[model samples]
Target: MKSFEKELPENYDALKKKANYTSSWRDRLDAVTTLSAYQHEKVIDLLNNRMKNDTVFKVQTAAYKALVAFGENVEKPTPARFDVIKGPNKIFLRVKKSLPKDHTVEEFADKLKRMRLDVYDAFEGDKGDQFMTWLEERWAKL
Candidate 1:
């Protein structure tokens, strides 16, 4: 299967075309998976076409996922909710308000600290998957 490297023009073109017009769903899947690594402007349209026109549901789904990975607005992105278990000795910071996009993990922890509650472990709500993902990503570096 061709890759998505821009240095290899053939790779980009192959993926852009195969992903949209390939006869084999397997080939289409291969192209869709590689689309995320390429940064061509037209690839978005190709993926969009795959998402909407592909005969195979799997291929269509793969295109949709690729679009999302590319940061394309396939749909509205929802903010994640931070959920903490209420505590007697352990205190969870539960904010009922909307948080700014620039809110940091340090700020989150510090808020709980100021409330004089010891954090055991923080839990995230279903809505907070993106927020938790950011935290987990930072934690991996440490």
Candidate 2:
């Protein structure tokens, strides 16, 4: 997989075109992120619109990731709280409400999977516990 760090450019038009494709979610997100770095209002609008309507999970996830990645450039504040956590090789987000303590780790993992967050070692006891604990803390703050 191509990393977003190397593929994005400054052109907003090209980035918009990339966002319309089905196969290049990561690439498109990279491009958008790069464009967002310039803090252009138009670029942010285009990316937000696409992200809200995107059908594919990967694309939506990428969109959300890009939103967080370029958050500093956004002019308007979003109602949703976005939190990002980086693991060994992937980045995950706490986009909405965190899991409850009553819920099993498997259940929480399932929820994350449903949201298409790249969760790792979800079945391992310690890791799962840590993830749940993380959610619990986040939930408490909410």
The most accurate candidate by lDDT is: 1
lDDT of 2 at 126: 18
Give per-residue lDDT, candidate 2, residue 25: 46
TM-scores of the candidates in the order shown: 0.43, 0.35
Write the residue-wise lDDT of candidate 2 on 97-121 in tens digits: 4665566545655665565443322
lDDT (Cα, 0-100) at 135 in candidate 2: 56
Q: Residues 27-101, candidate 1: write the lDDT tens digits.
A: 777888877566467777777887775545566677787777666788532222333333322232242122344
Off by over 4 Å in 1: 1-9, 75-142
lDDT of 1: 0.54
**TM accuracy, model 1:** 0.43
